[model samples]
Target: MYLVLIAWIYVAFMMAIAEATSPVGSLLGAAFTFLLYGLLPMSVVGYIMGTPARRRAIKAKEAAEREQALAANGIQNAGGDDASVAPNAHGEASGHTIAPERKQP
Candidate 1:
């Protein structure tokens, strides 16, 4: 991949040189040619090709952070095997209830 990029850069450089030397071509055209054909495409391709590496790096970093946090909290393992607690249940209505209305005098 990098070899291809290097080859393209070299080709673009030679083309730029040709443009600079040609009577009808200007230095600006050569600069644009190198930038558009060489640097720009290579950068885009490199970034695209590096996506999987970047994702793996991010996942690894997150896993490390999670492990560190769990270790700091003195947790030996993440999730499962813990005892579940049930809320205390009394067979009683808990809240205040309004008084029953009587017929007014």
Candidate 2:
């Protein structure tokens, strides 16, 4: 896919170079060749080729959001703020807990 795009760019670059070198063709003609043959088609093709990847990313993001929604629903249905909390070093319940300190014998 990318190889084709690269080839197109190379062709355009060469076309522009050719136009610039030719006695009959001006810098404007070179610019026209580069734009018409290279940038325009390549831009369109790149966007078209990129559609599938864009779609896949969107779908994956939706799936993630759906999973999050389901998980949130489950947590709400379960009805426990306590469940979100972890037991502390002293066995106290908190949002986050510290590791217990080990006493040396």
Candidate 3:
């Protein structure tokens, strides 16, 4: 039982680092996994139930910022029509086309 507990703690620490480095929902996974593996049975239940909500709250905040940027740029919806002009194939704008290189005799 003691060895099992120690193993769980080690796994939790690794999961925490993995979660911290990932862009989405990683921290939640790490938190829940750690709680389930390390906490007492009662605490495990509460952590499992609560962690997703916390993660969603964070996601919601990020979504709001994205929405604000889109609105400022006059975009109707998320990822629908991108109003921002893209650069040309050679990575220059229409007005700033690069002149072709001429061979020097």
Candidate 4:
């Protein structure tokens, strides 16, 4: 990824040099080449190519934060396997439902 950027910079430098030595108008050509070839294309391509990496990083961070929060709440981060987790709620594990303790007439 970074190699591409470096190669692009080298290309831009060479283009600018070529433009600066051109016969028509060196200054305008160099500026145009630097902006059009160097800054614009590289930035757009870099962003497009780096989107997946950025998204993965964001997902990893979010997952870590969610796991941290779940751990803080006494819940295990068992990779979303709910069956492996047991809550402290009454009768939750024994399949017994919680209801009122009223006497049956």
lDDT of 3 by residue, 3-103 (tens): 65566677767777777677875777878766765565535555676788889999989878877976786654634544444334355557636778999
The runs of at least 3 residues in candidate 3 whose Cα sits more than 4 Å from the true structure, single-residue gaps closed, are 1-44, 78-105
Q: Model 1 residue 82 lDDT?
A: 36
Candidate 1 lDDT, 23-93, residue by residue in tens: 99999999999999889998999899889999999998987886687678665553533332222245556
Residue-pair clashes, model 4: 0
Whichever of 2 and 3 has more TM-score, that candidate is 2
- Whichever of 1 and 2 has more lDDT, that candidate is 2
Residue-level lDDT for 44 in candidate 3: 58
**Prediction RMSDs, each to the true structure:** 8.9, 10.8, 16.2, 7.0
Question: Candidate 1 local accuracy as lDDT?
Answer: 0.81
Give candidate 4's error at residue 74 in angstroms.
1.2
lDDT of 2 by residue, 1-105 (tens): 899999999999999999999999899999999999999999999999999999999998986775587577553324433244322435666665878899999
Best by TM-score: 4
| Model 4, residue 41: C-alpha shift (Å) | 0.4
- lDDT of candidate 4 at residue 93, scale 0 to 100: 60
lDDT of 2: 0.82
How do the predictions measure up, each by TM-score? 0.69, 0.68, 0.32, 0.70
- Residue 71, candidate 1: Cα error in Å is 0.6
Better of 1 and 4 by TM-score: 4
